[model samples]
Target: MRIIAIGDIHMAADAVTRIPEIGSADLVIINGDLTNFGGTDDAKRVLDTVMTANPSVLAQFGNLDKPEVNDYLEDLGINLHKQARLLRHRLCLIGIGGSNKTPFATPSEFSETELAAFIEHAYEQARASIDLTEPVEKIKIPTIFVSHTPPFGTAVDRLASGTHVGSSAVLSFIEERQPALCICGHIHEAAGTDHIGRTPICNPGMLSKGGWVEITVNDTTVQATLHDRI
Candidate 1:
């Protein structure tokens, strides 16, 4: 399947207007940070704009997102996932919103311990619900994880201080489960793709400044491409 993913929109109406022409992909995934300031009104505008642009849009909340903002997106039919779910044509997607705790204490801040627990819980729940013995054709599909924070030490997460601010818990989870893909964005500068074991981890960067990432996946292979709008 062809998937176009982007993040960090930060409430840019121009970028939203340009999105439909980006490509006619089978699916569109918005990583996070849908607003400049996470207010209900701002979130409403962002959600309305995006839904109008793409009917197949899948999104999650960012660090700046408030509960009202999340509720608004959910009301507009965006999948705000703290867990995984299947989408168009059996594409499995999991979304975790927010980032590791920062000094500023943003809306989406989660301590490393809390984040790890959350991921672990989600994985266990998914594992319990699936029947592995069933044929792949008959059984539940595998998932591609989507989050706002990248896993630690990948090329997609190198900060300006030369530090890796990604989540070790996320890295561990991917190493264990090996999802089809991991798409994320929080650090604007660290926009690219790398692998955790067999799964590809991608950070599509920010959309407000006109950046995005595209990925193609089928039954067997996956590839990613990054682009910057002029």
Candidate 2:
């Protein structure tokens, strides 16, 4: 499976849609920030544009987006927020939308406990989806944790001002569970890659800046290639 993941769009559909990989990839994962303090209508505009190129879109709303946007995305059957869904080739996507509370007071911000709960909930959902008859080791599905907030203390969560503003909850979960991959965004300038143990993490930055991650998965092996702006 070839997946093109973009983040922090902030309504800049053209910047990301123009990328040639969008039309050809098996899936397009919109990390977050589909709107700028806007509602579902704004998200619709952005999602509609991306779908025009490729309709296989899985999205999560960011702190900048309204909470109600979740329902809208769910209605469309393309929402990945707080969800664990199976994709082709036994690939499972575990998603957590929104971000931890910030001083700026974003619309969809949640507390640390809430974020942690969301992560566990999504992971359990994925675990439940697989057949339990096989041994746990034998049925290890390739999983990707897509969180809007990057994990704390990683390069992807640091600010230009040198402050680490990532989610400690996310950090803890990643440390313990160690999913196949952690794809994140929210800190736009901190567009880079990092790792916790063997799990690779990628923050694709803002789509307005043309940052994206190309992931190719073959069985349990997942390779993520980060693409920065042109």
lDDT (0 to 1) per candidate: 0.73, 0.88
User: How do the residues 71-190 of candidate 2 rate in per-residue lDDT, one tens digit apiece?
Assistant: 899999988888888886378898999999899999999999999888878877776776455422246577788999999999999999999999999999888878788999999989
Candidate 2 positional error at 221, Å? 0.8
lDDT of 2: 0.88
Model 1 Cα lDDT, one tens digit per residue, 28-104: 78877888657778877776776676667778778877756667667767754566555543556667777887677
The C-alpha stretches of model 1 lying farther than 4 A from their native spots are 19-23, 124-142
TM-score, candidate 1, is 0.85
By lDDT, the best candidate is: 2
Each prediction's Cα RMSD? 3.0, 1.6
Q: Name the runs in model 2 displaced over 4 angstroms.
A: 133-138
